[model samples]
Target chain A: MKTLIAIKEQYHTWVHEAFPAMHPLLLPLCNKPFIEYLIDFAILAGSREVRLLSDGQLTEVEEHCGTGSRWGIELSYANLHPADDQQQLLDKNRKFCGGGRTMILTGYNFISYNKQKSYLDLATIATDTPIASCPGGTITLKGPPESGASEKSPLAPFSITPLDSVQSYFRISMETLQTGSSRYVLPGYGSEPDCSIGKNVIISKTAQIRKPVSIGDNVQILPKTIIGPSAIIGSNVVIDNGCSVSGSIIIDNTYIGENLEIDMRIAAGNTLIDPTSGVSLTMEDPHLLVGIKTWATTAILKRKTIHALAATILLVLQFIPFILLFPLLKLQGKWKDDPYMQETGLAGALAVAISLDRFPLLLKVITGKLDIIGSSSRSTCAGKHSYPDSGPLSRLAVFSYAEAEDWPVNGSDAAIVERFHAVHSTPIKDIGMTIKALINRLTKGR
Target chain B: MAFRLDTLNGITVGIAELNGRLVAENSTILQKTCSDWQQKTPFLVFDCSNLDFIDSSGLGTIVGCLRKALEKNGDIKLAGLNAKVAMVFELTKAKKLFSIFSNAGEAAASFAASPVSSKTQ
Candidate 1:
């Protein structure tokens, strides 16, 4: 049997806005994308090939699911006009629907089916028409001709529900987490009924696990953490120490800090969210935690350009001063080299006072390898640190707010100020901050 | 800084009416002003009838006030919280911490109907 999975534009519109970076079908329902359920259902129904039809961009979906080889089914993608109806969909993809019993699963709504039953047999014996569906979509059977019964029995009949609102989204996730398994075939693994675990999962012995939990692959649940009752943890996730996750779904590649009370929320990447109300909060403060997006190519290019310009300007402006002061300072024993400090510490008071230590780094900024003004270039030894991107900071500047504003060096407050400036500071802001830093340095006799 | 206070019966219920916005700049001001107001009665009502918005920091400060009031063997109840403010409170589960009422008069009367004993050490 062949399956045509057709999703309407209305579905894509909601999913696109609901999850901008994520694919709609792949939007996780209890740590598993919504599409996986549909795919699993199609496979269970004995579909040898499945064609996904949508008006929206399917690049992300295609990238994720590929050719459906993982599920041992042929997966193909096609585009549909917003006005296209069921007949139009079939006409457009006549070749794919060739001469066989075709099951058209249309709409953005979710299908509910059990994997345990032999749906392939049911497909053969069941009436040659749409068997069941909600108002949002339907599952109809269409094909040229079929032989007699090929193992005829109704599959475990299930109800397909539409995930329309944030409330429904939350409810579905919570229910799935609570049930630990869905009426449909779900991804991941479970040694027991209540827990569905995925690959490369690491649960610290110190962590507490309550039943009805779903954890995806490469997940690290740290010490003193409690997960469950209703929790869905996705792939490549890290839950730090002393945190509690109940009635929540942590999406892929998300890092949750220690002591965070995440309840009835969805932590997707860096955004802490409430799915019930569809109200998401980009955590403004770092101790609360923030999302860190991998630097995009555009950002890298922009950073490099700014760095190079800043480096060039600094090299030119400081040329005369460096040439004149170097020999004199060296002769006066004030310019003595400190290799030890360079190796073990950031520059000393002498370099800071002279403002010489920052000069070379400023050049690196122009080359686009470093921020003109950024986080203190210090590695985080411990704890969560937040940099504000939602606010005014643009992440490209020299002489961070921490230095110019005289925030205490290397402390939490300073860290906050620097992070705020680093993320918010733009190229124009860099000029202003650089001037402030220079003025402060000169006024302080440094 | 417009506010109102009334005592319904012997319960000594005081209502502080908040209007406009409650944010970081004025959140501290609210806390300081509420401290003095808290002295008038252990059980107080904040009539948020006109309160329109509240952020996380502002919500934190209010929760802090609750902790302070609870510490002093007193209680602070909320009345007429608008949808936006209520949402913020509910999202943080801060709503669970306070006794919420439909109106200021109802909240003030509630304090008299059931006087709370001190659980605070």
Candidate 2:
């Protein structure tokens, strides 16, 4: 059986509003991303292929999941119209669905299923009804039922939870933690009961951990800190000294300040939410609360080297035009600071043609402060909430990918295009796009 | 920031209504305004029902106001802090430093309900 996981952006709009920076599919449940659980469920249910369909941007999901080689399954991604019905969804993905058995998993819901059990009985579970469904999601089998020669329960025993709010998200995460991979294959290893710890964990001897806790990779529990009794700590997190964290989730890349009482709350960077209390706080002070970023060492080195080389070349190439014309234009009162908005007169036009206006930004790229091609937002520096809950999907750069593709500077699809390039771009391709971006910036409307 | 003097149960309380945003741009104005409010009454109640957003500098300014009030043997209580504003206080542990109430009246009344501080022994 093949699986088609149709999670439209509409079904999970709450995820967008609550955690604008996080892709709903990538939201973690028990240290495993929400999408991975779906994938795992599909794999266990006798499916070797899976396709993730959404009406929103999937570049981040794609970048993280890739071809699903790690899971030993073939995985693909596609887009959908938010208004499309089940029939239309099937019609759009007809080729992939084929004339064989297909399992349709739609809506933003969590499926409570046991991994150890064989859901192979679902292959023959044929009725004109949904196998199992919840408020926002349904699991249905499509195509012809496999020929069975024995009598058995047609549908497997399982339930779905409609994940439509932060409260639900929190509830589901806690539920997953309580289950502790017995029903699902959770990340990390458990040398003891009700406790799972990940790689690079630095637990001080003075620190104490209660039972039934899940800690992700690269976590540091400092001196005299108490973790768990039902805590979920995500990757790259640090709990400072003299703190008590019980019944809380410390999401990826967060720093818990000294002596803070975090009980029954979800801490994502500086934002802390008590789902029960319906209050979410954003701390402006990094010392009190902060999000950490983990960068790939080799990938960053490659990107910086390529960006630095390309920027240096561009700087040398534009040196003469900038030196000769910039000062003259400034003295003539024709040089505009915000040239991208509107550059008037022949001098300004000529300056644009030679790419003299982008000289300073290019120098920044050479200094490794900016990328040769990235998002054009100067204020979207790293370590800020530019991209929100997720890591930085876009960056401050000399030229944006939208400029390269000649998309409208502030167009709606600019984000879509920019994110696509941001995820799939190579440093080498970035250089090519940099040249195109400059050319497009110079001549797109002209 | 707008300040009004209120006499609740015979205790003089200064109530400041912070509006729009308390950010870097106008944070210093809040400090100066608080200094003026302190002259009329050291016990102040910050009516934050109108506050929509705040930055670190704005938070620092409010903390500064509280410090000045304390120096004059007075206290600053916060009232009607919307979820967004309350979040700022909660995250920085600033909420722990002040007495918070759902409305301005209650916050002002608290000053009168309690025994007044002894006059520096």
The TM-score leader among the candidates is 2
Tens digits of per-residue lDDT for model 1, A1-446: 88899987675455545444466678788777888888888888788799998876576689889999999999999999989977888899999988677888888776656666667664565475567777778888876535566553545676677777666777877776665374656678776887888888888999999988888888899999999768888777888888888888787767886666777887776566677677665544443444545446786676567656766777787777666655655565555453112311222344445466566566557656567665543422221322232222334344556667775655566556765566566667766776677677656642
Model 2 Cα lDDT, one tens digit per residue, A1-446: 88999998768877765666567888888798999988988998878889999877787799999998999999999989989877787888899988778898999999888887778767676674778788897988888887762455444567889988889888888888998468888889887767899999999999999978999999999999989889999999999998878888888889998877787788887788877765777776676678775668789888998999998988889898889988888898877666252456777777877678788778788788888888766323322332332346667777778777854545445655676787789988998898887777677435
Each model's TM-score?
0.67, 0.81
Alpha-carbon runs more than 4 Å astray in model 1: A122-128, A151-158, A178-185, A200-202, A236-242, A253-283, A292-446, B10-12, B19-21, B36-43, B67-73, B82-97, B114-121
DockQ of each: 0.10, 0.31
**Regions of candidate 2 where Cα sits further than 4 Å from its true position:** A55-84, A87-98, A115-118, A149-156, A179-182, A191-193, A274-280, A297-335, A341-343, A359-369, A376-393, A401-446, B18-40, B53-73, B117-121
Instruction: Provide the interface RMSD of candidate 2 in angstroms, 1 decimal place.
Output: 3.3
Best by DockQ: 2
Candidate 1: lDDT of A122?
43
Q: TM for chain B in all models?
A: 0.89, 0.93
Worst 10 residues of 2 chain B by lDDT: B112-121
Give the Å shift of residue A226 in candidate 1.
2.5
Candidate lDDT scores, in order, read: 0.71, 0.81
lDDT (0-100) at residue A445 of candidate 2?
37
Candidate maximizing lDDT: 2
